[model samples]
Target chain A: MQKTFKIVDEDGIHARPATALVNTATKFKDTEVFAESGGKKVTLKSILGVLSLGLEPGDTLSLIAEGGQAAEALSALQEVMVKEGLGEVQE
Target chain B: MDKTALSKDILKLVGGEENIEQVTHCMTRLRFNLNDNKKADKAALQKTDGVMGVMINGGQFQVIIGNDVPVVYNELVKNMKGSPEGRVSSSSADAGDKKKKNVLSSILDFISGSFTPILPAITGAGMIKGIIALLVAAGWMGTTSSTYIILSAIGDGAFYFLPIILAVSAARKLGSNMYIAAAIGAAILHPTITTLLGAGEPVTFASLPVVAATYSSSVIPIIIAVWLASYVEKAVDKVTHASLKLIIVPTVTLLVIVPLTLIAVGPIGVIVGNGLTDGISWLFDNTGLFAGLLLGGTMSLLIITGMHYALIPIMIASIATLGYDYIIPIMMVANFAQAGATFGVFLKTKNSKLKPLALSTSVTALMGITEPAMYGVNMRFKKPFIGALIGGAVGGAFLSLFKVKAYVIGGLAGLSGIPMVIGATFVYSLIGFAIGIVVAAVATYIMGFEDEPEAAAAAVPAATADANASSSNSAVIADALEAETAPKVTEDIYSPITGEVKPLSEVNDPAFSEEIMGKGFAIQPSEGRVVSPVNGTVFSLSKSGHAIGLVSDNGAEMLIHIGIDTVKLKGLHFSPKVTAGTKVSVGDLLMEFDRVEIEKAGYSTITPVIITNIAEYSSIKPGGRSAVKEQELLYTVQA
Candidate 1:
């Protein structure tokens, strides 16, 4: 399962949101979650990998999850993104 | 100690702060766990100031920082905002992920870890002891004078109270509180304990008979005590609650460990220490000269493997229990021999860089540290090292034959400790020093091992090129004799620059096109740098920075010219490493040139490499296509 989100927060996906995203993704078992921006993809659970993407305000990101729990993991990750005011979900 | 820049530079060299998973220090090195080792700049880190050496051992990137490791480690941790707690235990567990260490590394690691932290105090005391011995021998100081007594206290105190220092370091290495470990060491050497032992009174620890072993100047006891303390401390920490941890942990640890140490640890350590000392003494007594020769010759090799630390227990034990040690005297010969070898290389090496290194390292080696001399000079040239070994063996044998022994443990492997060999006959020490140095230097000079590659290269050419020249001079018989013994062979010559290859005749300059500078091909180089095309030593590198003459190990002499009429530019567009006798392998970087600047200076950057000894070859032909890259076969010579 994959979904696109437009970054609404002026700070973008900085440390706090990156940590939140990683913490949410790690809660799921056997699901691979990835955040890709500007043609670069990184494991969402890795803070360093996500920060390396350098996502800024107005930048679009594709959140991807693969495995048996892919849809559920992706939905949890998207819910945190919206609740944290990091991005607006675009299904 | 306030080396912010050095720590910052280290982080940069080790792939920046982000790449570092954790940074911890032990004795002489900063152990780092990196996220990606591939990102590390090993060459840059090695070349960085304050970094003694860099190594990747057991999945950890280790930077050897020498004695000031704690200070540097502090700055490194502060800069990275990393904790220094549990570093040794964590790293050891990380090491456990790999295959277990062989017996050799395990012993080395244990010895080095226990001794490295206390090296400064030991070395300082050793040097002071050496100085006192010198003063006493010179009649400048009385044996029982107040000044002498005070100095002796300062000099001998470290050796006498070694357990306290070893406890602190060993506890750190073993992941335990240093103070608690030190408290245990202090208990073993307490005034009450010493008095009881001196009084010949039977003592008991909670009804268990206490072992009457003197712990002063002891090496093994404190190490064993602290190692045991780490486990006891860990168990105490596990059982104790957080609120009661501070008082309960240490009190329980001391209560359990103090008695255990007196009954088991000290007695066992005494046995082990005595066994080592006796074993060494047996070897010296039974084998005599042969034992000295063997120990002296192989000491440096032990240093290289880091097993030299294992010998420290025996030396200290011999000094403490036996009053003198033969090992110390033999070690002195080994140090001086290494210095002598470096001095020999300084006189013999033709390499510009190695000469200065040999000279400086020789001086430092004379003062007692042989690492620079060993790693940078003698070992690089095998013959010089063998010369040193032979010299050490001879000198050591002489010292043993004369029954020479060191009354005081001296400082690092250097001349600073010469005065410590003041036992019975001091003259033997003097003779051993002189013979070790002179023999090693003379042997290295006579052996002529600095550049065997160049000598081998020169030998073949002396016959073939001379025969070619002599045949031209109507000495046909000598030429026929040379040819009968030596067969004609073909060798490949690679392009030194990357570009479009052009025949020498097609090059614009008449001097090159007309074959005035011998026969070869030219390349209109796209890259600015020039690389060596053969494995050889540079015989002649022109001062003009335009040409380099090299002779391969197989005696193939080749010349590389940067540009036509470029020599007239007075080297403005060129920068070269023109050390005339530098050894270079194929694809080694020789120099960088400004190709655009050379072209703008009204000179074509069509570089050519010509075989100056063209007459010795049957034919020289173009090896491949017009467009060539560096290391591509540009010419083939059939001799």
Candidate 2:
């Protein structure tokens, strides 16, 4: 499953939010989650990889999940992103 | 395994090349992010010969190597996993918490990183400015002439456009796009904006009031602006589609950063720069000699810490606003004082290896380049550094009393810079420079410093032996005299053969040439016999009888190689007198070789007497002599 989220926070995907996103991704097993930004794809579960993406405010993040728990992982990641004020679901 | 072998072995023990995601190094350790932590043989790696210590923190494995870590790191990256170009990708950011940079290092890193690239540019221009000032003072060129105008413009270009130049370099350092950051530099210095600000008209951008700060010739503001743009550009990139990123990133970054700079960054930088200039001027006006002493004494220390760059803006601003500055003259004395300390070290040091270095660095220190003198000579001897500081303070006080000023920006604080100390202040500056060097040299000579602790340590046993021998009997004194009147109690090395003593630095082989084998002296062997230079046991005797390693009872290790590449001779003309593990005393025959036959074999017969465990000692004093007899004092190594 693939979903596009527009970053809403003034500071986008910084340390705090990157930590939160990685923590949320680790909670689900049998599913691989990735975030694509700036034409680069990084595993969302690795804080360093996510930070290397250098996402900032008003940026679009493409979140992808694959495997048996893909749907649950994607939904949980979206919720974490929204709750943490990192981004909002686009449609 | 040795350092290189250990470095190679470490790669396999840590799950080979594929397992390492990233590798970086700090001052002492090679930090690596491994794909599988469990795959590494931590215990085996720790036991490696050259690996000092091992650490695993925050998902990174660190191998501690001492001063030779860089050598091992080069071996690993160059020979093992890296490409032909030997470029190892350094992703310090992805290495987790292990790569955390604290505030002090960050500021240091920033200042050094930002200034290093532009120094050559400024240095060249500064030299030209000095030349121009000289030309004008000598009446060689009129300041208003067309030729003078063109040359001055070329000279002034770097300083005037410094903000724009800093913007490009700073942007690259901050990992932002160079053009966009430079555009911000351009916008700040734009004719329209400068005109509006100059006319004292109230300016507004997007209906928000603009703070009028003259941003030309600035440094810090553009650096701050570029740093901000790095974040702003990244943010813009994250939201914009790949197709629109090229346009949107620049547009949004400019629209957001330009106004922010005029309203905030530029104003703050102006205030900071102005405050430093005012504060220094106030100190000079009120405190006088105290202020001079404080600045002069600690100026080199500031350079050491990299806080000296903070004063550059104040100097530039003072020259721009006040037409002259007192700080440069004081700094010139500080530099010359350091040179004087180096001269003192050169005169007093018994270590021949340091003498040449001290001499050259002293010359450079007088020319206002103190790094070689500061790091190579003065800091090596703590007392000399203090002497320099005292000398600088003394000179600074004199200069302040005379109210000397540096009227022009120049390349260095050296003698050549006297052209910039024009007007009545010139004579005082010259006097200050002379006093600084003299006082520093005199103080350093009087204070006196110890260089080789190993030589000193060796002397202790020799002293005790003399006392014991003297107290034992008249018979012991006869035995000592029979042994060619040798000092029976000191740790000093005696001449193994009748020959002229030469400093090891003059040795032909690199092993001894660079003092890597240890600090000792070389001998032009005039005789065929080689005797034990120290009262020690033979640690090892090469099977070929060309080299012998000895360990003294007091723990000094000496390596004696008879000839250059004599190992290839295979004992043809060499004969051994002492076997491995056999005890030998000074003047005892260890080996004998035919000097003429060895010379006929195309080998240089000069032998290097080396202290293999030299790092244990603070200094090693080479015996400076033209010629010596057997059992004559060769050199001293103190612990």
Candidate 3:
């Protein structure tokens, strides 16, 4: 399952939020997730990925989750963003 | 009655304010920017109040305020604004107007200050790249496989979309349209351009040297280009009508710049970027390892000044060419090493205020942005910065010896460069980094600087402030401190201003001046009454009652001063309290003072009120400033 989101928050992707998303996805070994745009895919577990999207408000990003926890993974990622004040949008 | 005695004691030093320009402070130093820096009775200021030492550097007058600098700097900046000259003083640097920053310089500052915010992205990506290298080396992921896709993007994402970051940073630096910079960056990083370039053969669109250095992961080139673009945008905006300016300028710049950029300019600029990388490599190869060693050691310093950004392209080029350079790891060690050194200071100091700043700033340094640490804590200490340098030197030497290299282009921050060491070099990198930390810490501790949080105070006055004998009131006799000497006769007589007074021993703070219990006294001063502390001529009192210098009937030279950092109040409400040649009696009021307004100005009311000429007296008794009545048994100096 894949979902798209725009990094709507002002500071773009950064420290606490980026670290939160990366560390969260690192917990799921059976499930793999990544963020993509323009055919370039980056590991969802990599803090560098979310930050490098350099995603500013309105920049749409697709989050791809593979395997059993795909829907849960997307929901969980969104929950993390909401909890940590990241992305400024639902997954 | 030591208050009057203490007041009298103070009347004999440095021939007061007619001498000083401004007085300020750092943690351990009282920094004074003297109007007539020459007239400053440094010996007097040092002896006044709770002074440690004075250090003058880079046009900044410094007082070694000790671990209490931030606290004291606030006070000093508030108080030291008193220019005895009463001319334009830094105190006039009031809340709002002093914001007069050099517009261009601050822009530059922004570019440099902004680097740390995005460093984690670069480090994480670089580390992932290193991990990917390890993975491929282990045959766990084929280079062309989907697994490689995920991992490569994980590592390469930052560099791949680097222009986006540069755009935001450039927007901040240029202070121009941020989104415009990002849009322009997007134009530069457009996939069509990448796809076209990947078509392989040299593609020529036009001839403007649209030097596309592939803004993807390159640090400097994009920054420089965007900065230039901003200027063009600015200039174009001025000429075109407001509405059309933004639309036309960007459109024209894109249209004309694209084709032109593709041909002569693009290829040339690209070459320039490549050449820049090669030139650095050339320097490394030709200069021997000396170049790496030099940069590695001083790069932290350079980063402190933000000049290190100038070399980012070189490191990037190294990644482009040999895919390796030793500088980043060296910088990493230097960064952490500096943090470690500052951490030592944080550990050794007992100062309540200094410890937290040291810890926080050191953490920031470990994160690779050292400016806050350097400016906030280390440089203030004087030795920690030196410790950083020593650490850097050893680390540089180690890096040079190990010949370790970095495989990625990134900010010179963090341990991301560790895994990029490739082959047997990893061990050397680790060894070098360890040696750096150890050398820095051991050197800092062993240098005997660890115990002295107040080191600035000790180093402050070793050098004399003035050599011009003709200019200053040379009333102070060069006699040393004598415990049993008789009171040398002088025209100078200092008086306690307030009515209430007591023995100097009653007011407490670590005894008067080392080992002497309140030899210096305090007065429970009336909020605003100024009296002549001495009977001697007011050798100096340049209009502001903030300070007064007098020569006693006996030959003692002293100055009676008021309030800590009260000089910043700038004579607004306080009366001159006295004149230079005023004749005074023990009870005669010299000048009406204002303690309320002084306190209102955010200054410490704990006025030192001391005698600058203590060396002349065998033993000045404790006349408490707080309890003794006027003209009581203040001082019984032996004659």
Comparison by TM-score, 2 against 3, better one: 2
Displacement of the residue B497 alpha carbon in candidate 3, Å: 9.9
Per residue, candidate 3 scores C-alpha lDDT tens digits across B15-47 of 233233333322234433333332333445445
Candidate 1 lDDT over B17-113, as tens digits, reads 7666556665456877665553576545655667655655434567766557777877777776544433432233223223334455555655666
TM-score of each prediction:
0.57, 0.52, 0.47
Question: iRMSD per model?
Answer: 26.9, 25.2, 28.3
Which scores better on DockQ, 1 or 3? 1
DockQ for all models: 0.02, 0.01, 0.01
Ranking by DockQ: 1, 2, 3
lDDT at B44, model 2 = 57
Model 1 interface RMSD, one decimal: 26.9
Give Cα distance to truth, residue B9, candidate 1, Å.
3.2
Q: TM-score for the first chain of model 2? A: 0.95
Q: Best candidate, DockQ-wise?
A: 1
**Candidate 2 wrongly placed segments (more than 4 Å):** A1-91, B1-100, B127-148, B319-325, B349-357, B407-424, B451-639
Compute the TM-score of each model's chain A versus the native chain A and list the values. 0.96, 0.95, 0.82
After superposing candidate 3, which stretches have Cα over 4 Å from the reference? Answer: A1-91, B1-110, B113-124, B172-183, B186-216, B235-249, B256-272, B283-288, B312-322, B339-378, B407-424, B450-639
Quote the lDDT for B333 in model 3.
Answer: 76
What TM-score does prediction 1 earn?
0.57
